[model samples]
Target: MSTLLKPEAVNRPSMAAQAAESVVIVMAGADQLPVRRKGGAKPVSVDLLAALVEAALPDGFGGVSRIGFETAWEAMAPETRRALTDDLTCYLGWSASEKRQAFPADPEDLVRYLRWLEQGRGFRPATLTRRIASISRIHRMLSLSSRDTLPTRAAMVADALKAARRRRGSQQRQAAGVRLGPMMNPQDEVEGVTLAMLFSVCTSDLQGLRDGALLAVAFESGLRVSELAAIHIRDVDPQADGRGILTIGKTKTDQEGEGRYAWLSVDTMRRIGAWLEASGLEDGPLFRRVGVDRRQGRPARAPQDYFSIPGHTRHWQERLQGRPAEPPLARYAIGEGPLTRQGIGVIYKRLVRAVIDEGMVELEPGREGDLVRAISTHSMRVGLTQDLFASGEDGAGVCQAIGWRSVSTALRYVRKQSVKGGAVSRVMDGLRR
Candidate 1:
């Protein structure tokens, strides 16, 4: 079991202040001696002595909390602390390593370390370069004199930065051409559900009702996943005419320190009302999961021991299982929360997978020749945007309805269908002229 250390335990002497001074003595590997103070009460200096030993412990971001650092320092011997401080200072200057032969001999080790950072640590090229820069800064700071030539380290950092930039540029170029083409066909007309397909997907059940409501909102409002997830039940003002007005708290492009609201179609209100009533959810999270019994292929009649409204529950694990639940069913409950990042990803993946598996929609193959099938929840937003633009909705109207901060961001979603229609219209007009 891991131990928790409190910062208050090491209040006698500040460890950070002594680190530089303690390193010099620790590296020489000499036994520590007690010193007497002149005309002063002698405080027990054992904690300071023990700090030396703690300095030699492994360095990592994981265990480097302020409390942990203090606890480790308090536990070390003063002699060890002094020696380590000396060695660290010397290593920083690259002088002690030459004398004691502590530096790695093989150049291959550095390359291996870089690979390990990229693969194991999942560091992006930019992140890896930053890490190298941090090391270079440390070497410069710790070197005894300013004139020390750390040319090798400087050269390695420069080469890594150049490679990182080249890789980033190549990725941006590739992405600009057909990034969404793999996940969706921009040219394909909206074919699957039309407004009728939306009605077919709706069910009397709470979960089904909620799904229906989400679909209605997506279809009518053309809300982005982030905008949809951020919505609260209170933000939706249901009208008697079956239409509703939604007050969006924030959007992707607009972090402008304020929220915006918009009116939606009547169909959206009806679906949302059906869902809220069926779910028995009076307030709080707009969407929630039902307690499923995999063994019986049904939902629980009464609230299970683990049923909780979103936000009140800290983790998804709490809602996952009962005393007897199948592995497949248990997997469904894991990490699902309303309006969470993970929850959005999970919902989108499941929705797309279900649509594809049930043959409700057929997505085109990615790229020109590749047969790899792809579809995602974001396709709904893209599809809707394309549909609107093709219908001759002006750019300002589209931007306002979609809650886009910039016209350019919305234009990216305006697919080839819109462009092609415009081209055909122009040609027809030319013939008349």
Candidate 2:
């Protein structure tokens, strides 16, 4: 069983100090501020955490021993807390359904749960691994406060997990890329959905302008969906060369708020300017939802037929009584809230479909569905990584440009292009057939 380390034994903030800081920040509504702390903003609300705990845990935080968990919660990053809570909630729900005690999970029960997740639910290895980690972490927390033991650390459970992993290989599926054309030759033909193709399908209306700017900025900055949604008008500044530089106050990799800057091409800047001008948004979220309300116009009034049925005659008479024809009109309402991550994915798919329907792009016979399924929020980020690799940029350079803290993470997206230009390919290609 994994042992719970004393919070004080680690290099964590003092419990007293963290509690005071959390209170002060919560009262001041620091999370709601657009600008953030040195690291990323602690946007997760304490109330939300408490509610999740109360609903998920068998016994709520009525006891004094569990106060340590609350204190430890304050020290965690916002994303970590959110993920753990979600994982915990899911496991607890399953435990309750199975009539099992979750705090001190049984080794046999844990193994059974793993099998259900893998076989019954058809979860991938990564998800099963994360679920195990979540159970272990929660048990560790309970061990710190209560008498719970770490059943996840049991040898039988470990062996079961190993066997399961062996049965189901651990390869992860990478999201398909929405690549721009070749970096060195920007005008070169790209087979799949390219950034240029997506732009071509974007019209001049409010929704189109917003989508264009969003895709352009996402591609240029290599921002994750959450980071893209958090972008503000105030964070972007135009440059002398007609391009612009965006100040990313915080990113998934740079949560400590040691901010980074991303370059925006002249084309991207122009699209952003058009979106901002059309939407008349000066500040707040850069990409907000544009609600479309379309009203169909009525044609010129028709003369009422005297022999018509009573209801039809009355309707026609009313229309003929000086009701003028209305023109078809579409109105766009800009929302105050930013586009959600899901909304961004939907936008990408919608535009991709549009481009295909307009004949700007084509797919192999019976392979159209595969392309659509592969495109995801990560597509833009993957495309950026691959484009950099294709342009002869090193992995480290790509990591820095894309705000990846580890070179290993960036390596995941450098497959086809990197292989084509590797040492083996170079030596063979150098000697003509």
Candidate 3:
């Protein structure tokens, strides 16, 4: 990405300083988007900024391949960015210590490093590929003139990749389903969890409303946990027929940034409406932090969701004139900050257990444990996809419904579900007659 040289704020000391004998080249484009404290009051020289931009280029990335643009990098999921960062850090440390140079542009050095990672550290081929991508990123930081001086060794690095399949075949651990059959709420109450029971025994407060709504929406929508956490108040579009539409602005699949929409079931919409009314939500992120304050005697502030409503912030400000806002005076309290993806998982597990506590269904001794193990932040998405496949939804229909970008992804989801009332399996059963 063309480094925006934002505020010339050096996030941290770069490897260049250590390798280049303390000649500091500010790493261009790190955390340029998020407004932060400026690096220093003194303005940076144009020459230094130019050097930083040059130093930041990956090895073979030329000006023509859109590698210089930051949009795609910025759009990556937080987890992906963090992994890349870690991989790069690991490579730089190893290369500096082993090769006597921190950043190596030569193809031979890159290959040796990969072998070291594989033979010495026992890093898997998949991990090696990720590290290679990171190496490319660091290479891009070097000056364009330096880029030409070095050979375009990226292809050779790719050729050097160890076969992942032979050494350590890896696959994502698929989440287990909460239920089967057409999407339905809990039926009976006897030590099993379901959406109905979870909602029924909710704390009867704002958090309860939100969690219940979140659970229902997650099950109905089949959203990835991160995508679900990213939902905004304005994304919900109500329809005349009681059903609603949900706009997913960004997802892993949407490379072009043109977002897609999903249908919101009538039942799901009702829970969401209840949550909106209870929280006084208006516009902004939908899910947020909700908990009991550690201190005593404090009602929660109005949710930021209500900030768009006229007089909403003013009304609250007027109520507590000079007083600092405290947690709810009552036992429970909620906050306006958004929940991270991890928090979403915690909430899901808590609600699932709550369902079990309410005796939602008669579970055999080990069945509850099975359900507990199966249910995760990803369970709803997996369960919904499986249910759709089990209910005779074709591959194309399933992908569209589940917001899957490819038929292959759709196929992977239902592999385990294939035997559970699957279309071809059901038809094949008739042969026994």
Candidate 4:
């Protein structure tokens, strides 16, 4: 993976910065393509863009000329480019297997595809929504280039999407929250894994120290996995009260580079300090990959006389020489690069298992897998939102705290618990008491 770009490193020429040096909009199928400096980064290849444009064209039809495709590719964010590439590739592959045209997709065929995705492939509505958006965006790009009609905008496709929504429901499955308390809502008496439970299971080992700090910081700040992984050493500011303030230079919502702040408790601060001291990291990304080397110990044995097991001979000889058996040992190697978002999710799940093993968070038999599957990289963010809502914080407060652009998005996370504190519940409680 490429090194993560620093939030404030525009002055340092990176791949993204270098790519901007060469882009020049020109006519379709121009004599020469845009050229970067000798060592500068190259744009996405024309061949791949051509293939996508080709796949998007209907039978005996051509649209989205070379320059048009190039312009669309150039305008996309790196993340969007990667996602769209995958989405289009998947659609084309599926269409080929089904022996159907993918580009300028027919409404009837599109409905069949949507059915296959939902019923046959067991895809969620959210995944279907994204796939549809990918198709729509491609069609829109083509329409802009060649004045072609948008197929995805057809009424049939809209009706198919509406039917899918009714069948599957539009509410997405949310990651389970890892609240600060055992019971996210005390009135409900619902108990689950908590940050306190996780912290209790965190050992003094290098992995434990890092996991503790990572979870603590993530929970307090309600940072998404990408933002959590991008945390640098300099982003932390210590407060006089022992708590610290974390500066988030960029977020999914705040793309303008305007920073936001979150409070970190003294406990979280101490965990961060412990991890830094143990890892001996003076700078750069705070969370990093930790490689563990474990050497297993073997029991001392007498030298083999009559028959010898091939690999056991050396161990037998050592035992005969009276040398003590090697003790089991584990050493951790810290990585220089930041932990990826996927890596952070793995760490969270591993810690969840550890907490379960330690009996800090208990579950009914056969439900362990369910709990593990429910918690994800977004668990900390979801957990923090629920915690805030349970504590009487409104939607606006949650929006501001978590840097959400809208109250509706913030409220979506706590929809289940909101009813417990609603007017009906309050009125009923008063009458009953």
lDDT of 1 by residue, 1-433 (tens): 1111111211122355333222111111112222212442223343432343234223441322345445544544443334444433333333233332212212233344445566665556755555454333333333312434543264554575566566553221111111212223333455443344434544433345566667666556666665776676777876555457777775655555287766776555666666655444555657544332233223334333554546567644535543333222211121123543334444444554454455555647443112112334454566556666666787788788776666776676654455656677568866976
| Residue 277 C-alpha lDDT in model 1 | 50
Compared with the true structure, what per-residue lDDT tens digits does model 2 show for residues 1-433? 1211112211223456433332111111223423322543334555555565555555653432357677767666656777777777777778889998766577888888888888999988788778888778666655533323467777888787788778987777888888886555432234588898888888756678788889889999999888999999888888776778889986666767899999998777777877776566777889876666566667766655555537545466564454656665665666677777767888899888887788776677787777888889999999888888777788889988998878888887765557667788778876976
lDDT (Cα) of model 4: 0.74
lDDT (0 to 1) per candidate: 0.47, 0.73, 0.61, 0.74
| Candidate 3 residue-wise lDDT, 168-230, digit = tens | 654555666654333422221112355556556666455676886787778888888878988
If scored against the real structure, what TM-score would every candidate get?
Answer: 0.47, 0.80, 0.61, 0.78
- lDDT of prediction 1: 0.47
lDDT, residue 66, candidate 3: 38
Compose the digit string of candidate 4's lDDT tens values, residues 1-433. 1222221311123566434333221111211322212642234464675676686566667555777778877666555776677777778877889988777677788778888899988988888878888877877666633424566666887788888889989999988888887554556444578888777777656677788889889999999887998899888877776678889986777666798999998777777877776677767989887766566655555554544456556565554455445545555666667877767887888888987777766778998999999999998898888888888888888989988779998888878888888888888987987
- Write down the RMSD of candidate 1 (Cα, Å): 22.3
- After TM-score superposition, the amount by which residue 298's alpha carbon in candidate 4 deviates from its true location, in angstroms, is 8.1
Model 1, position 154, has a per-residue lDDT of: 46
Candidate 2, position 373, lDDT = 80
Separately for all candidates shown, the number of backbone clashes (residues 3 or more apart, or on different chains) is: 21, 4, 33, 0
Error of 1 at 222 (Å): 3.3
List all candidate RMSDs to the true structure: 22.3, 14.3, 17.1, 12.6
Cα error, candidate 2, residue 358 (Å): 2.9
Q: What TM-score, to 2 decimals, does candidate 4 have?
A: 0.78
